[model samples]
Target chain A: MILDGKALSNQLDVNMKAEVAELKATGLSPKLVVIIVGHDPASQIYVHNKHRKAIKLGIESIIERREADFTEAELLQLIDQYNCDDSVHGILVQLPLPKHIDEGKIIRAIDVHKDVDGFSPESVGKLFNNSHEHYPVSCTPKGIMTMLSHYHIDPKGQHAVIVGDSNIVGRPMGALLLNAGATVTYTHILTENLSAHTKTADILIVATGVAHLIKAADIKPGATVIDVGMDRDENGKLVGDVDYDHAKDVAGAITPVPGGVGPMTITTLMQQTIELAKVADHRTLQPVR
Target chain B: MILDGKALSNQLDVNMKAEVAELKATGLSPKLVVIIVGHDPASQIYVHNKHRKAIKLGIESIIERREADFTEAELLQLIDQYNCDDSVHGILVQLPLPKHIDEGKIIRAIDVHKDVDGFSPESVGKLFNNSHEHYPVSCTPKGIMTMLSHYHIDPKGQHAVIVGDSNIVGRPMGALLLNAGATVTYTHILTENLSAHTKTADILIVATGVAHLIKAADIKPGATVIDVGMDRDENGKLVGDVDYDHAKDVAGAITPVPGGVGPMTITTLMQQTIELAKVADHRTLQPVR
Candidate 1:
């Protein structure tokens, strides 16, 4: 069975339109401010999609544009502006900031409460520590969890194997799965025997950016496979890390590239932005201690 | 073979004595401040051992004792004083803090720079994120890693299983093993079919605090087991989570309860304090920007 992220994302977006309107009726409008540096075509497309989704959901959207030569200090200043804005509930700095700016430094500077992207160390820390207070989770993994629940796939007690250990996907995904009561095994570039680990997975998540890295032979029968990779085949067509044609035959369920994890990422971002807005509004209602 | 944490900890203490003296020669002496509230007998013994180890390593030690009824505000105030004091290089709040005082609240209050215990979320975040900057790791996990190296057990490309997910030991232990290039699996109380997960380990670390919870059948043959449990059996004899007598026959190497992870925890705390002091001094030497 194909896990249709696009169909699910569309359904979520439709439901959110009403929720956003209800919030607006109460005079609390959710707002997201996205900062993008350079005209990196890929990042531009991503930023545009985020903006479109926010507008569709009745969210107030603002995009701050900067040249490729934007100084690290200037970007930090822009983030500070959004952090202090009362109307802005969520802030996202599109990645691959010009080489001159330190990405880690920029991420550390964002207020955890306003970090919609969930790339900040504090947000990552909260996710791993199982913090009591609610904080934004990284969109890709958060979306994956939502999809699993939507499909009625419970990860509890399942053997989850994640290929790749990138901070953005593999590492956080491992933490999330472990938190959900799955025994997680992480295989990366340094892993000695990749197949030895993959064949053991009850739920396999691949995000190595290597097209067709996983195949039918590597997957266990009835395993649920989630492909987070967005790569190109020799024919210049989009492909995921898993060989979908073969894996689909063996996998109980699988997500395909382009139409799979892609749409869900933007959808999760829109969802979290509204959640941040609702949380902020709730805080305002509480009498000052 | 028994992995002798006691002998290794003593050797580390000797080396640290000379290291601390070398730093002291530079006129920046290392100091550790331990705060204990309500003197639970177990906490009292642990605090005393820490103070003893600090003095032996040529590091200054200060123990702040508070009554059982110490208010959370008063505890925070005490932490603030130490945070500002230039002489205090490390601050440790012994665990099982009075029920009235929120332990997490007090932990977050400690400055990360002085958090030798590594209970703060920031320290933990740095560990999992593999941050380049220096930060203290939770002592028990740090000690286990050191023990692994001393025994020449490289976890790289190995399957490491951790049988606990507590914030202090199990979670950080998994992060450390994963960072060391191991495909790590985490099993906790919530884990179903626990033995199924345990039997696949190349290197197993058990810290579940359940006496004799793991038996020979649960261990993979020739696996290196690091038991972190300190539980008393029916006869009131100290034992570990692993049934050592039975496990030693099947396991390639293992640690005994009394002389294993227990001593190394305090030893790592002392070592980290000295390291923290050196890092602070290096920062001071940097030319003013």
Candidate 2:
């Protein structure tokens, strides 16, 4: 069965709507500040979608538009402003910012409580320490688990192999899978005999934007596959790192590009927004164990 | 060959003492603050050993003696007092503080910069995130790696099965091994068929304080075993988690309980103290790493 992220996100949106309505009744709507640097077409599309989603969920989202060449000083200035803004419940700066600005610097600049992207070392550290007191998990990966559950993929005791070592997708992905009780292996280019590890994985997640890096032969039969890549293949069409056309035949479950993980990324973001709103309201969304 | 940590720690002090001389040439001595909160005889003995080691190496040592019934406010106040004191390079509040004090609360109070025990959630989180900035690693696992290298027992590409899940030993040990390019399987009480994982490990580190928990029957022949357990067997003799008499006959290398992990634990704290002091001077120490 395919993991329907759009369906999951829709269901999640309804729950968030109720949460936002409750916050509205208290005369304080959840507010989010999204800073997008540059005129990147993809970033524009993302910001627009996020704004629309927040509005539909009764959230107040203020988009702080900045130039592609925004100075580090300017970017941090906006972040400091958001950090102090009582009106801003969450803060996210669109990633892949211009090369001049240290992405980590800006990410860490946001107060730990306000960093919704969860990329700050402080935020990432909390996830590691299991002290996530109001920590916002990365939307894409959190969405991956949500999608996995939607398709009923219980990772417990399974061998989960992630074919990337990126801090964003690979490392945290391994941590998440490990937390779920899966025997996790983080494989990278440095790892000798990559196929030897991949073929044994009960769940295979490929996030290296190297197009067609993972094919049907790289996966175990009846394994679950998650593709978290967006890159162009030889045909110049957006394809995942996986050779999905044939992989679907061998895999028990899979996520498709554009429809699978795409919708859930922002959907998880909005959900975190509502969750953060509840936290700011001095109410607990889930009891701390 | 027993991977003797007592011998290793002694050898390390000789090496680190020479490094400390160089460090003193620059007019700064690696300093450690050993805080004991109770009159626990065992804790007193451990603190005394650490204090003696630090003095022998030309390192500055401060023993902050506090009563068993100290108030939470007073303990936190002591922690805060050290947070500002520049002479204090490392802070170690002895474990198992009196019952009235919440260990978790006290653990959080230690400044992450001076958290030599590396038990603070911040340090643990940073270790988990693979970010090694200004954070002290937990001592015992660092000592385990030191023992591995001193004995030429490199864990790279090997399967490491650690039997225990305590924050002090098993969990961080798994993270440390994985960071060094090993396939680590962390087993706790909930893990089914404990020996199944242990038997496959090329290197096994048994840290569950249960005496004689691991026997020769549970380990693969020629596997390296590092016993972190310091429990007394039924006969009232000190023994490690592994039964040495049976284990030594089969295992390629093992560490004895009395002379194994115990000595290195204090040595690691001293090494980190020197390392942190050098770090403060914009230099890095190469002896341990």
Candidate 3:
């Protein structure tokens, strides 16, 4: 069975749009401010897509763009301005900032409450510790969880193998699975006998950005495969970490490259923006003693 | 080969003691404050042991005992007092606090700077992210890493299986090993065929708190096993999660229950206390803008 993320994302959006209207009716506008430094072409496209999504969902989206030569101090000051604005519910700084800027420093500058991208150390800590409290996580991993739940694929008592060690997707993805009761194995570039470990997984998540790193032979038959890779093939076609065309024949369920994880990520981001706004509103509604 | 955590801890302490003296000579006295609420017998003994270890190393130790009826607000106030104190380098609130006090709230109340036990979300987040910044981690897992380093058990490219999912030990242990370039698998009570996972481990860490949970048959020959469980067997004798008597023959190296992880934990706590003191002192010494 193919896990059609595009269809699920569209399905989820209908409800989200209605929810946003209700929130606005209650005098709370769900607002997201995405700050992008530099003129990276890919980042421009990503920022545009997020803006379009937010507009469709009836949430306020602001794209703050800076030149490639923007000073780190200037970027931090801009973030601080939005952070102090109670009107903004979510703050996202596009990653891979200019060479002069420190990515970690920029990430740490965002308020944890408005940390829409959930890259802050505090949010990451809460996710890894499986805190019972509501906390935002990296959009990709949290989106994957939503996909899994929609498909009724429970990770309990399963062996989930994460084929990357990235802070963005693989690490948090494994933590989410582990919290969901899956015995999770994390393998990275330095891992030895990678196939030996991959073949044991009941649920395999490949986010290595290595095209065709996992062939059909590397997969366990009947395993649920979620591919999080966006790599260019020799022919300039987009491909996933797994050889999906062949692996899908052996795997019980799978997600395709373009339509699978991509749409869900944007959808999850919009959902999180609205959720954060509601949480902010709730906090204000609480009566002071 | 026995990992000999007790001997290693004593060996490390000689250097730590001298380091403490050197710091004191430089006009900085490392101070640790431990707060324990209610009289849980095990917690009392653990706190006492920590206090004793700190004093022996020439570091200042203060124990704050609270009655069972102490309110959560009072506990938070106490933590805030220590958090604001410049003289105090570390603040440890003993775990398994009275049911009335919320553990998470109290942990967050501790100044991340003085989070000696490393239970704060910020510290935990740093551990998982493998941050380059200096941060303390849960002592038991940190101690295991120290022992592994001393015994030359490099986890790089090795398959390390964690047989429990406790936040304090198993989760952080896996993250530490992952940061060290190991392929780490985390298994817990819900894991299917736990032995199947354990047998594949080049290094196995068991902390299920279930006596004799792992036997020789569950181990792979020549695998290094670290047992973190402190359990009481049917005969009222202290034992670990692993059946060490027989499993030791199959294992290449292992840590014994009493003389192993326990001693190293206290030693690591002391080491971290001093480290936090130095960091605090360094922050204060930085030139003002």
Of the pair 1 and 2, which is ahead by lDDT?
1
Binned by DockQ into CAPRI classes (incorrect, acceptable, medium, high), candidate 3 is high
Interface RMSD of 2: 3.0
RMSD (Cα, Å) for all candidates, in order, is: 3.2, 3.2, 3.2
> What is residue A50's positional error in candidate 3, in angstroms?
0.4
lDDT, candidate 1, B1-289, per-residue tens: 8999999999999999998898888797999999999969989999999999998889999999999999999999999999999888999999989899999899989998899987777777777787776778899999999999899999998989999998899999998888888988888887788898899899999999899999999999999999999999999999999999999999998999989998999999998888778776773332100
- Model 2 segments more than 4 A misplaced: A39-45, A149-159, A180-182, A193-204, A210-223, A242-252, B39-41, B151-158, B193-196, B212-223, B243-253, B281-289
lDDT (C-alpha) at residue B82 in model 2: 89
What is the C-alpha DockQ of each candidate? 0.63, 0.35, 0.82
Q: How well is candidate 2 docked (DockQ)?
A: 0.35
- lDDT agreement of model 2 with the native: 0.81
Q: Model 2: per-residue lDDT, tens digit, B1-289?
A: 9777877788889988998898788788778888898799888999999999999998999999988788988999998998888888888889888888888788878777788888876677667666646667889998998889888887777877888766788778877887787766666665556786688778898988899999899999999998999898788989889999999998888898799888999899898888778776778656334
Stretches of candidate 3 off by over 4 Å are: A283-289, B283-289
Task: Return the top candidate by lDDT.
Answer: 3
User: How close is every model to the real structure, measured as TM-score?
Assistant: 0.95, 0.88, 0.97
